[model samples]
Target: MLAHSFMSDEKKQNSPRPLILAVEDHDDNLVLMSYALESLGCRFICQKDSTNTVLVAKEYQPDLILLDILLPTISGIDVVRYLQQDALTCNIPVVAVTALASREDKERILKAGFNAYLSKPYMIEELETVIRRLLCGKIDSTSGFELCKE
Candidate 1:
């Protein structure tokens, strides 16, 4: 339940950056994600487990959520269900960051309410791409993302 914030110096000097909520049970994974999110100029809160995730999400109302599927107390899929049921945090985009890399796993996770999926062992570039798209992209009539008009 350790929460920390990071921002790139340039982003700090400019407009406010996106705030992200990352839920991961592993300390090492949390550290790695913190660095990656920092490099992307995002302010993030990291939760070590899913026990208080719904409360935390409601409190913060971050722009996006990075959730690990296999979490302690409550699984990430279940967490998404809880988040979707709550109006305060329902619209925030959720990305599944998990080791489950199979096609079936990806399909299932997306069907479970995650807006995006990123397999574990992902590169920083991939993480950056996901963050950028979800934060900057626009939701279309079909409930899918599209490049925002400039």
Candidate 2:
């Protein structure tokens, strides 16, 4: 299986693309994230196995990480803890993207050190906003997208 997942677009070459590390176990979810990143003119590295996440993050040092909370072997929270402890990968921003939509779940996720929390079945615009906000520190209001509330 390919460890990295992305779709190339020549039009995005005018400028450097932001590198994103996506940790998702499901193929469909990876595809969806790939589409989103492609549309945003960004490059991404994907890992289906959570156990290798910290290793990959340290190696690639992506600008941002989209992580799923639940995984087959190790939970995303554990992965985050590993990343946080590693000086090489500690500075990268991590966003929780999962099905955990309850208010308490969101709070717990934020408390666990995720820079942002985005629930599953999210809108494309919402995904873009969060990515831009965390990576760029601000959203482009000209995109006419509003913040999504959970």
What is the lDDT, from 0 to 100, of the residue 125 in candidate 2? 82
Top candidate when judged by lDDT against the true structure = 2
Per-residue CA lDDT of candidate 2, range 1-150, in tens? Answer: 334444344323434567788889999988888887766667778778787788777876788999999888789888888899999998999999999999999999999999999999898788888998998743233442222231
| Clash pairs (backbone) in predicted model 2 | none
| TM-score of every prediction relative to native | 0.81, 0.82
Query: Using alpha carbons, what is the TM-score of model 2?
Result: 0.82
Q: Tell me model 2's lDDT, rounded to 2 decimals.
A: 0.80
The deviation in Å at residue 61 for candidate 2 is 0.6
Worst 10-residue lDDT window, candidate 2: 141-150
1-150: candidate 1 lDDT, tens digit per residue: 444333334332324667788888787888888887765656778787788788888876788999999976789999999999999989999999999999999999999999999999888668777887898842122211222222
Q: Which regions of candidate 2 are displaced past 4 Å? A: 1-15, 137-150
